[model samples]
Target: MTLLRRLIRLLCGTDPVLRRMLKYWAATCVLYVACIGMLLVQVELGLSNPAAANGLIAFGGCGAFAFYLLIRANARLKLEPDQLAVAQAVFSLVCAFWAYAISGPLRAAMLIMAVVIIVFCMFALRPRQTLVLSAVAIAGMGATMWWLQAHDPVRFPPATEALTFGYLAGALLSTALLSGEMSKLRSRLKRQKRELTEALETIRLLATVDELTSLVNRRHMNEVLKAEERRQAAGADTCIALLDIDFFKQVNDQHGHAVGDSVLRCFAAAARASLREGDVLARWGGEEFLLLLPDAAPGDARAVLERMAERVHAMLVPGLDGRRISFSAGLATRRAGEPFADAISRADKALYQAKESGRARIVLA
Candidate 1:
């Protein structure tokens, strides 16, 4: 048993592709064996020449095995399955032609085997490939029929071979047409699937992003705060801030809503640049932004807001006429087990106080 297992492994490699090839070859070998048996039966019944039939069997059996072994030995080739099928079609056709020529009175039955090859190609080959293969089969069989009529008229009569060619042509051509139609359906479905995926991604972006400032919107920010609140429950320190642009309504009134929008966009860019890694910023509502600093100390959070204010002061939006911008912030640290909304409420009160005292400073809560 051990020796037999080793021999099987030696013949069929352990790769997934190799194992699959073994199964394919097993099915093909069964067909070859059946054909060999058919040839031997014809010879025993005196319907075919024993020597000629035996030679064709020997050639077919050896040729098919050689192709199988070649594919197995180069399992890493990763050959396209259609290309492999095409190779098998060519090999099978050559054997069928030989068997037809020598099978004598039973020559027409070989067309059935050719039909099987055409059906396999219908499933395996693309529309254009199927067309090319059909052309080759038609041409090869036509040439064979012409030769047999000229040299062996007694066995391959002109009228009979003519009828057989017509049957072969109609069968192959119709199957190829159906295969092409199936290919078009598959391609259209694949294209629609790709388009659906892209549409879903666009919808997700619109759901979570503020279209004006390009920051995370209030809804998504609330989700982030909930996540951070859970972290705070486990002894992690997080700070929350609510910052408002100073005199934003006046900017909109004086310079128009366009200039106000530019200022907001500019402030958002500066604030993002000033924040450290692991900081989350969002557009909470008009002119107001929320900031979350995870795993941070109160002092560190203060420094981050101060740095952001400095950057904001340096920014000049379009239509500002060289005037600079600044913002006021209310900062608060989350206590262990405190809810995120409570922390945000405290920050909002501090923000109102900062605006009353001065517009460009941060007030701690």
Candidate 2:
């Protein structure tokens, strides 16, 4: 079973585009098989010359094999899907015309083959392209039938040829019309699918992200903290820090909330740049942020918070003229089997102690 699975993967490959190309390619190859079958039956019934049937069969086999290799190798990366569909339609029509020209009694099968071609093409081509393909098939076959009636009137009678063409014309035109309507329906469904995906993404961002600083929101942070607490209980090192920007209310009260918002944005940007790749920061509340450091020792997590505090102290808030930004942080390394709420409460008390100890410093809990 594993060997069979490996062989299927080798032939079909893992590329989605290549698989789609091969699907249509395989359908066209099936039509080639039908053509060869018709030729063999015609020769057996003595309705076609054996010499002519042999040559046409060879041509059909070569065409199918060559096209299979082209589609399997380069067509997926190079050819537009509609262009490939049109090419396949043209090839199928050419082979059908060749087979019809040689067969005497079983020529009606060629009309069925043409109908199959148009119906298969509906999956890939537009209405206009299908219409064009239908017209070409009807005209080319009609011309071939008329020419054969003139040259071999004993085998292909004028009355029989005319009636067959009338049936062919109606079937192809009606199929073309229905294919166009279905193509339109398919386009509308694709558009609706794209719109639905975009709307879901917007809703997700609104639920989890803060609008002002574009950081993760408080509720989502709580979820992340609880997950980290569980990992800590399982022997993973996790740390939490409560960060509060110092003297932020005065910036809002004196310079207006617009400047305060700008300052918050600047602080978020600086704090983001200071953290390692695995660390997460979220807006805990107005003028307060939360930081999560997973898989870190107590001393290392404290050093990370101290570095973040230094970055806040050295940076300039955009609307503050030449004034610097400062923040106070309280760091707590999670103890085994402790709930995040208890850790947050201890960090909050440490934040108060930092405020009392002249601010702009980090206090370890």
Top TM-score hit: 2
Clashing pairs in 1: none
The sequence of per-residue lDDT tens digits that candidate 1 reaches over residues 1-365 is 59988898888867787788677767778888999998999999999999989889888878887877778856567787778878888888888888888888898899888777777677668999987887778788888898999998887889999999999888878877877998898889989999999999889888899999999999999888877776567535789999999999999999999999999899999999998998999999999999999988889999999899888998878898888888999999887778888889999999999999977889999
Error of 2 at 100 (Å): 3.2
What is the number of residue pairs that collide in model 2?
A: 0
TM-score per candidate: 0.76, 0.88
Candidate 2 per-residue C-alpha lDDT over 1-365 given as tens digits, one digit per residue, 9 for 90 to 100: 59998997898788898888888788777767876776788898899989988988887788777777777777445867898789878878887888788876778877888898889899889999999999999999999899999998888899999999999999999999999999989999999999999999999888889999999999888888777766567645888889999999999998889999998998898889888888999999999998888888778888887787777778886668878888888888777777878778898989989999999988989
lDDT for position 68 in model 2: 71
Instruction: Per model, state how many residue pairs clash.
Output: 0, 0
Candidate 2 overall lDDT versus native: 0.86
lDDT of 2 at 213: 98
Instruction: Give all candidates' CA lDDT scores.
Output: 0.87, 0.86
Model 2 pairs in collision:
none
Distance from true position, residue 259, model 1, in Å?
2.1
